[model samples]
Target: MKRGVLLVAHGTRVPAGVLAATCFAEGVANRLKAQNPLWENVLCRLAFLEISTPDIYAVATQMYQQEGIRELYILPLLLLSAGHALADLPRIIDDIQRDCPHLRVRMSSPLNDHERLVKIYQQHIHDALQQESGIDALLFVNRGSSYPHSYRIFQQIVQQTSASFPDLKKTSAFFAGLGAGLSRAFHRLEKSGVRECLVLPHLLFPGRLSAQLDRQLKEWAMGHAHLHFRSAPLLGESDELMDVYAKQIVLFSLRRAVQTV
Candidate 1:
C-alpha cells in the first residue's frame, strides 16, 4: 500500500506563526526525501488543527483523492500531549476515518515525551549562553498546559537539564500560570544574586506566544543593572530535529504495519 506522512500542527492566528510551522514541515519532508530514496514517491503534506490554513481533514482527504494513498501517518507537531494532542486530534482522525472507511489512517504520538528533544533544548541554551558571561542561573520557559502528567514530565526534564549542566543554576518556569509569570520568575532568580539569566523556550516554533515572551523580556530588561536576560531561539528547521521527525515517522510506520499483520 502506498503511504504518506501528514505533519499536523496547532497553527496560529498570527501569520508569522503559521509560516514558521509550515516552513518546518516542508523542511522535514525535504530531509526525509533526501535521506531515503524510498520516500520520494511517498506523499508528504502539512495540516493544521485551527487558526491556520488547510485543516486536518481537508488535507488528508485531498491527499487520499489525488495520490491514491492507502496508508496515512498523522504526526502531530505539538509540544506536549495536551487537549489538542489527546482529545482534539483523535476526534479529527476518527471523523476522517468514518468518512473514508477504506482508508488506513493512524495517529501517532505528539513530539512530547521524546528524549531527543532534550538535545534540541540543550543546543538552544548552549548557543544562547555562548554570547553572555557570568551566567549564574538558567530558566527554561515553556507554554504551560493544564494537564498534570505533562507538567510533571516537564519538571522531570528540567531536573535532568539541571543535572547535565552542573556549573550553572537551572530551573524551569511557565508563561501561562502557576507561581510567577516569566518576568516574575526572573525577578525571583535575580533576587537570589544570579548575575545572568537565559530563558529557553520549549516551544517547537516561533508563534504569537513566543513574540509576546520576547517583548516581555525586553521590557523586563530595562534598567536591570545587576542581571541580564536573553531569550533563546525558537525551534526551527535543524538537522537534529529533522532526524527526530523522520525516525518518528519510520517507527510509527513499523508499529502500524505490525498491528495489521
Candidate 2:
C-alpha cells in the first residue's frame, strides 16, 4: 500500500507560525525516514485546519490522485483535546472518508496530557531560567478553550508542574477563556508581592497569540522595571517531539495491521 502521513495544525495568520509548522513536519519526515526502512516509501505532507490554505482534504486528495497513496494517517499537532480535537477534526475526517472511500485513513490522539510533553515543558522552564534565582512566582499562560475538559487538563498540568518545583510559587492564566487574563494574573501576582516572575507560554509554536503575549509582557516589563519579568520560548521543533510522532505512527500502523488480520 502507498502510505502517506498528513500532519494537521491549527493554522495561524502569522507567516512564521506556518513556517514553523512546515519545518516541524519536514523534521519528523526526515527522522522517520532515517529511523525505519518501512517509512522510506511513506509520503509526508502538512495541512492546516483554519486561516491557512490546502487543508487536510486537499492534501489527502493530492496524495491519492497524484501520488497514488492508498493509505493515509493523520496526526494532529494540537497540544490539547479541545473542541477542535473532539469535534471539528472528527467532522473533517468523516467528510474526507466520504469523499475518498478507497483510501484507508486513521487519526491518532492529540499530544495532550502526555508525559513526554510535561517533561519537555519542565526542560524548557529550567533552560529558560538558567540559574536565575529569587524568582517570586512562575506564571503559566495557556491558550484557553471553551471546552471544560480542556480547562481541567490545563489545571492538571499546572498542578503537576507546580509539584515538580515545590520551592517556586506557580500560578496560571489564560489567553482567552476562563480565569484571569495575562494582565490580571500579573496584577494579582504583583499585589501578592511577587517582584520577580518567570512567564512560560504553553504553546506549541510561535503564532499571533504568542507574539501578542510577548508584546504585552515586554510593555509590562518596561513599565515596571522593579518587577523582573522573563518569558520562555514556545515549544518549537525538537528531536524528542519528532520521535513522539514517529512512535505514534508506528503504533497506529501496528494496530491497523492487527485489525486487518
Candidate 3:
C-alpha cells in the first residue's frame, strides 16, 4: 500500500507560525529520505488543527483523491497530550476514516518525548547562559491544559528538567488554566531573591503567544531593575529533533506493516 504522512500542529494566526510549521514538515520529509526501506517512497504533508490554511481534513482528502495514498499516518506536533491530542484529534481521524473506509490510517503522539525535548531545552539554556552567569533560578513556562493528567505530566517534566540543574532554583508556571501564570511566576521568583533569572518559554515555534511573551518580558524588565532575565529561544527546526522525528516515522511504519501482516 502506498503511504503518506501528516504532521498536524495547533495552528497559529501569525505568519511566522505558518512558516515554521511548513518548514518543519519539509525538514521532516527531507530527513526521512531513504532512511528506511518502508518509508523511502513515502510523502509527508503538513496541516493544522485550526486558525490556519490547509486544515487536516482537507489535506487528508487531497492525499487520498489526488495523490493516490492508501495508507495514512498522522503525527501530532502538540507537546501536551491533552484534550486536543487525545479527544479532538481522534474525532478528526475517525471522520477521515469514515469518509474513506478503504484507507488505512494510524496516529501517533509526542507525549512521551519529554526527555528528548528537555535535552534540547537544556542545550538551548546552556547556549543562552554562555555570556552571563549567576542565573540562580529557572522559571519554566508552558502552554498549560485543563486536563488533570496532562497538567501533572507538565509539572513532572518541569521537575525532571530541574533535576539537571542542581544549583538553579526551579519553578514552573502555565500560560493558561488555574496554575500560576507568567506574572505570578515572575513575582514569586523575584520575592524569592532570584536576582538573575532564566525565563524559558517552552514553545515549539514562533507565534502570537511567543510575541506576547516577549512583550510581557520586556514590560516586566522595564519595571523591575532588581531582576535580570535571559530568555531562551523557542524550539525550532533543529537537526537533532528532526533526526529523532524521522526515526519515529520509520518506526511507526514498521509497526504498522507488521500488524497488517
Candidate 4:
C-alpha cells in the first residue's frame, strides 16, 4: 500500500509562521528520503489546523482520492498536549476517517517533554545569552494551555532546563491562560531584583503572538532602563530540530507497520 506522511501544525496568520512549518516538514521529508529507500516513495504533505490553507481535512481527502494512499501517519508539530492535540486534532481525524473509511490514519504523540526538545531549548537559550553578561534570570515563555498535562509538561521543561544551567535562575510564564502572564511574571522578576533577564519564547515558529511578545518586551524594557531584557528568536530550522522530526516519523512508521502486520 502507498504510504503518506502528513505533518500538521497549529496555523498562524503570519506568513513566516506558515513558511517555518513547511520548511521543517520539507526538511524531515528530505531526511527520510535520504536515510531509507522505503521512504523514497512516501508522499509527504504539510497541513494546518487553522489560519492557513490546505487544512487537515482537505489534505487528507486529496491524498485519499487523488494520490490513492492507503495509509497515512500524522505527525503533530505542537509542543504541548493542549486543546488542539487532545480534542481538536482527534475530532478532525475522526471526521476524516468517517469520510474515507478505507484509508488508515494514525497519529503520533505531540512534541511534548521529549529529551531532544529539551536539548533544543537549552541550546537556544545558551546561544541567546552567550554574548550577554550578568543574566540573573531566564523567563521561558510559552503559549499556555488550559489542560493540566500541558502545565505539567511546561513545568518539566522548566525544571530540566534549570538543572542544566544551575547558575541562572529559571522561571516560566504563559502568553495566555494559567500560570503568570508575561507582564505579571516580569513584574515579579523585577520586584525580586532581577537586573538582567533573558526572555526565551518556547515556540516553534514566528507568528503574531511572537511579534506581540517581542514588542511588549521591548516597550517594557524601555521603561525600566535599569533592568536588561533580551528576547530570543523562536525555534526555527535547526539540525537538531530536524533530527527530532526524523525520529518521530521513523518511530511512528515502524509502529504502524508492526501493528498492521
Candidate 5:
C-alpha cells in the first residue's frame, strides 16, 4: 500500500509561515519521488499546530479516509523535543489513532542530532561571515526553550563549529524565554575583545521571531562600534535539509512496521 507523509510544524498565524512550510513539504515529496520511483505514490500533506490550515487530526484523518493511506508517518518540522514535540504532539497523535484504528501512525525525530542540520547552519553562518568582514565572533542563536536537553544541542553545535574558525570568538544564545538573553550575549562577546558578532537564527522561515532578531541585531549594532551584527538566513527547503527529513521519515516508517509485527 502507498504511504502518506504528514509534515507537522508549530505553525504561525502569518501567511508567510504557511507558505514556507508548504514549500518544504513539496520539496521533500519531490526529492523522495526522484530517489525511489514508487515514492511517487506517497501523499505529502502539511499540518499545523496553531497558525495554519489543517490541524494534525484533520490531515491524518484525511489521509486515512480519503487517500486510502494505510501507513502514515509524521515528520515534525521542529529542531527540539520540547513541549510541542514531547507532550502536545504525542497526545494529538494518540487521539487521532483512536479515531482511525486502521491507520498505522509513526512520528520521526525532530531535526536534531543530524549532521546535515549542522552543515546547514554552518553554511548559513559561513556565508554571512564572508559577506560582512565586521563579524569577528559568531553566535549560533535559536528560539530557546526551558528544557536543558534541548539547549545542550546548541552547545554541541558551537563546539563543533568553533574549531573551524579558531580566530573568531563564538557563543550560543537563545531568543525564547530561556538561557542567556541575546542582548547580554552581544555585550559579552563585545567585552571579550570581540569587535564584531554574527547571530545565526536556528529557525526555518522569516517569522515574527526572525524579524525581531533582525531588528534587534541592527539596533544593537548602532550604539557599539565594536558590536557589528548580521543575522543568518533561515533554513528553507534546501537539498541538504530535504535529505535529512527524508531519512528520518523512512527510518520512522520502517520502525513502525517492525513494531506492528
Candidate 6:
C-alpha cells in the first residue's frame, strides 16, 4: 500500500510567512525520505489550512486521486491544540475520510509541551540574553486563542517553560487579544518593575505577525526608553525543531504501521 505525508500549516498571505512554512515543510519532506525507511518512497507535501494555495482538502483529494495514496499521515504545523488544530483540521479529515472510506488518515498531535520544545525555548532565551545576566522577566508572545481549553493548555506550557530558568519571571500576551494584549501586558509588567526582558514569539515560522511584533517592540521600546526588550527568533528552519518534528512523526507513524501489521 502506497503512503503519503501531508504537512499542514495555518497559512498566511505574507510572502515571508509562506516561504518560511513552505521551506520547513520541504526540508522535513527531504529529511523524511533520507532518514526513514518507511518514508523512503513516500510522497511528502505541504498544504495550508487557509489563505495560501493548496488547502488541506484539496491536497488530500489530489493525493488520493492522483498519487493513489491509500494510507496517509498528517503532520499539523501548529503549536497549540486550539481552534485550528483541534477542530478545523479534524473536521476536514473526517470529511476526507467520509468521501474516501478506503483512505486511512492519521494526524499527529500539536506540539504542546514537547520536551524538545522546552529545550528550544530555553535556547532562545539564552540566545536573546547572551552575557546579559539577571532574573529579568520574560514575555511570551503568540497569536492567541479565544477557546478556554486553548488558554489553559498554553498557560500550562508557559508555566512549565518559565520554570526552566532560576527564578525567571514571565508574562504571556497575545497579538490578537485586546484586553490581555501586548500593550496591556506591558502595563502589567510595569507594575512588576520589569526592567529588562526577552520577548519570545512562540511561532513555527516568520510571518507578518512576527515582523509586526518586531516593529511594535521597537516602537514600544522607544517610548519606554527606561526599559530593555529583546525579541527572539521564531522557531524556523532550525535543525533542532525540524528534527523534533520528523522524529516525532516517524515514531508515531511507524508505531501505527506496526500495530496494523
Report the number of the highest-TM-score candidate: 4
Task: Kindly give the number of clashing pairs for every candidate.
Answer: 0, 0, 0, 0, 0, 0
**Reference-based lDDT, each prediction:** 0.78, 0.81, 0.81, 0.83, 0.78, 0.80
TM-score of 2: 0.91
Q: Give a tens-digit lDDT track for model 3, residues 115-190.
A: 8877877887687668677788888888888888888877877888778889988888788975889899988988
lDDT of 4 by residue, 1-261 (tens): 888988998899999899898898888889888887878889999999999988999999899999998898888888877888778888998998899889988888776337877787788778866777778888999889888878888888888877878888778888887788988887888888899898878788889889888888888889998878887667656767777777778876776642221
- TM-score head-to-head 2 vs 6, winner: 2
Candidate 4 all-Cα RMSD: 2.2
> Which scores higher on TM-score, 4 or 5?
4
Relative to the true structure, candidate 6 has a C-alpha RMSD (angstroms) of 2.9
Q: Mind giving the per-residue lDDT tens digits that candidate 5 earns over 118-184?
A: 7777787678767887778888778999888888876777777677778788887788757888888
Over 1-261, each residue of candidate 6 has an lDDT whose tens digit, in order, gives 889988998888888889889889888787778788767888988999988988998899899989999998898888877788777888999889888778989888766336677788888787766767753899888788877777776677677778877566788889873227888888877778888888888787777788888887888889888678876778875778887778767887867642120
| Among all candidates shown, the one with the greatest lDDT | 4
List of clashing residue pairs for candidate 1: none
For candidate 2, write residues 30-104 as lDDT tens digits.
888889898987899999999887798899888888998888888888888888877888888788778887888
List candidate 5 segments past 4 Å from native.
255-261
Quote the positional error of residue 12 for candidate 4 in Å: 1.1
Residues 1-261 of candidate 1 have per-residue lDDT tens digits of 988899998888878778888888988888778877878778899999988889999999887887888788888887777888878987888888877777888887876435777777777667766777666788888888878887877877777766667888876778774434676687787778887887777787767788888887777777676777776677665568877787777777776632221
Score candidate 1 by lDDT: 0.78
| For model 5, the run of ten residues with the poorest summed lDDT | 252-261
For model 5, the local distance difference test gives 0.78
Residue runs of model 2 more than 4 Å from their true location after superposition? 256-261
Look at candidate 2 and give me any clashing residue pairs.
Answer: none
